[model samples]
Target: MENIRIFVQKHKKVSWLVLIGYLIFCGCFVFPLSNERWSFDFEKAYMIILSYGILATLFTSLLSSNKSIHVYSISLLCTTVGMILRYIIEYGEYSNTINFTQINIIMYLGIIPVFCTLIYWIICKLESITCK
Candidate 1:
């Protein structure tokens, strides 16, 4: 916990760049167009990204404490922006309207700290590995 905070604070600029870049570059993956209908399944897309993000967060965090926060934030922000952009792009192609709600905004904002904490804990585990 303390180490992650110290790391983040020490590398504030890099952290900010990492977050911004993650948010922007998430959608760079190529997707197959054969199952066009699957593109509309925003729910499935969100679940897939979140699931993978969590797993990645776990692995990366476990590998290096100083690296966990960066990895977690990158994964979370990337998946989030990727999913939202995918939804917007798909819906826009068909001229469909996507609804936004206050609850959604609140939910996203609420999860930020929770995810950060999860990442922090994973990073904290590094103490055990490095202390020896």
Candidate 2:
């Protein structure tokens, strides 16, 4: 508990970014989007996304620590792999006809990591600004 609090305090910006990014991602589910429904392999895709999200959150929490960058890198890698897997699955199953739709959905999932990367970039920029 103490360590977690210290981590949070030390990496306040990153922590807030993670929280906000997660909220935004979750909020996207509420709207009645056309491709919101699950398809044949919905369970697998959902599981992958859930796992990726958890890993990303954990990575963000531990990012400020000097122990290892493995966790953060793995989290990002998992997200990329999951997105690719989603695209491949959709493409293989549906071919060109469904490719566009699958691409859009996969793009939505891709945004998760992009936001995380952006958050890190923003934090770095802020740090540079503070130092200057």
Model 2 misplaced regions, further than 4 Å: 1-5, 9-61, 64-75, 78-101
Q: Encode model 2's per-residue lDDT on 25-116: one tens digit a residue.
A: 34333211124354436665565456445534444455553323454354345544544554555565644244346565566445555554
Candidate 1 RMSD to the correct structure: 8.6
* Predicted candidate 1 versus true structure: per-residue lDDT over 1-132, tens digit per residue: 456546666776775566555444443232221132344366656653574444444434334555655655665666567546756666655522222334433444345434554645644665567868
Which residue pairs clash within candidate 1?
none
Full-model lDDT, candidate 1: 0.49
**Alpha-carbon local distance difference test for all models:** 0.49, 0.49
**Model 2, 109: alpha-carbon shift in Å?**
3.8
